[model samples]
Target: MEIRLAGIKEFSVADGPGIRTVIFTQGCKNRCKGCHNISTWDLNGGYIQEINSLISYIDSICPNKKVTISGGEPLIQYNELKYLLKVLYKKNIIYAYIQATI
Candidate 1:
């Protein structure tokens, strides 16, 4: 599946429990007050990426670390994200986190 993304941080310490690779997906329904990623709220604002390429990139950069899926509300693209999570699960990657509002 293809995933729309705002950006990807190869390394992050604040996203989750440990050092993690943060995947910032594009598109969010919420426009909460004090939102920091306002630019990512548009559904068509970010580049599309293939799920495999994303996983491969993560593997190449840093594997076995936590992977945080943030937004633009990561759940906005639920199907794609679900598939991505499934693949990650099948690969024995257990440390995945999703940051979403509601």
Candidate 2:
């Protein structure tokens, strides 16, 4: 299965520990008062991203770094996040963080 994504940010230090890969999944139920990416709330707002391709992209990045799943609410697409975490866990990268609003 695939998830809709607003965008992906690579090598971000603010996301978590060390340089990180940040995946911004699309769609959100919460309309925050001061959301940075306020444009992403629409349920059908972003492009569909293949899970395999995203994993491959993450694989291509330097390991031993952090990975973050931010939103537009990552829990909105829990399956993909769960699957991605499984892959990251197997690779011994335990620093995957999630930034979402409920």
Candidate 3:
């Protein structure tokens, strides 16, 4: 499977506890006012990335750290997110996700 993402933050302390690799998935329906990542709201925006390659990249660069899947809206790509979560689970990597609610 493939994932569309606005970008990836290799290291972030504000996203969650400890340093984390933040996967900023593309697309969102919320369209919250003053949203900082408004550009990520387009479903067809951002570049496509292979899921396996993403996992490998994270494994190599973000080992022993939490992986935070933020967005645009991570849940918008739930299937791919689930797969990514499963892979992370097998690797014993901790993860968290954030979403906007209204």
Candidate 4:
């Protein structure tokens, strides 16, 4: 499975309750006025990445093995995100958050 991403933060404390690996998923419907990730608004703008690759990287370097599926809006790519979560769950990785609006 593949996902479009704005960026990935391998180690981030601010995104979740603990040190987490944040997946900045691309595409958002709501153009919130205060959105920090202006670049992520475009659904086609970010790079395409294999979900396996992201999981593998997180497994290797993220000490907590925790992931935060953040976004422009995560639900924009629901199928890919779902697969990513399934893979992460199989690995016993602790996924801290999955943000979506509607």
Best by TM-score: 1
- Tens digits of per-residue lDDT for model 3 on 1-102? 999999999878888888889989999899888899999999999999999999889988895558888888888888999899998889877755565453
Q: For each candidate, what TM-score against the reference? A: 0.94, 0.89, 0.92, 0.92
4-101: candidate 1 lDDT, tens digit per residue: 99999977988888778999999988999999999999999999999998887877776655688899988888899999998878876677899888
Each prediction's total of clashing residue pairs, residues at least 3 apart in sequence or on different chains, is 0, 0, 0, 0
Q: Report model 3's TM-score to 2 decimal places.
A: 0.92
In terms of lDDT, the best-performing candidate is 1
lDDT of 4 by residue, 31-91 (tens): 9888888898998899999888888888898787788988889988879988888888888
Q: Which stretches of model 2 miss by more than 4 angstroms? A: none
Where does the lowest 10-residue lDDT sum fall in candidate 3? 93-102
Error of 1 at 38 (Å): 0.7
Looking at model 1, report the run of 10 residues with the lowest lDDT sum.
57-66
Mark the regions of model 3 whose C-alpha exceeds 4 Å error after superposition. 100-102
lDDT of 3 at 33: 86
The 10-residue segment of model 2 with minimum total lDDT is 57-66
Error of 4 at 47 (Å): 0.3
How far does residue 51 in candidate 3 sit from its true spot (Å)?
0.4
Give all candidates' CA lDDT scores.
0.88, 0.83, 0.86, 0.85
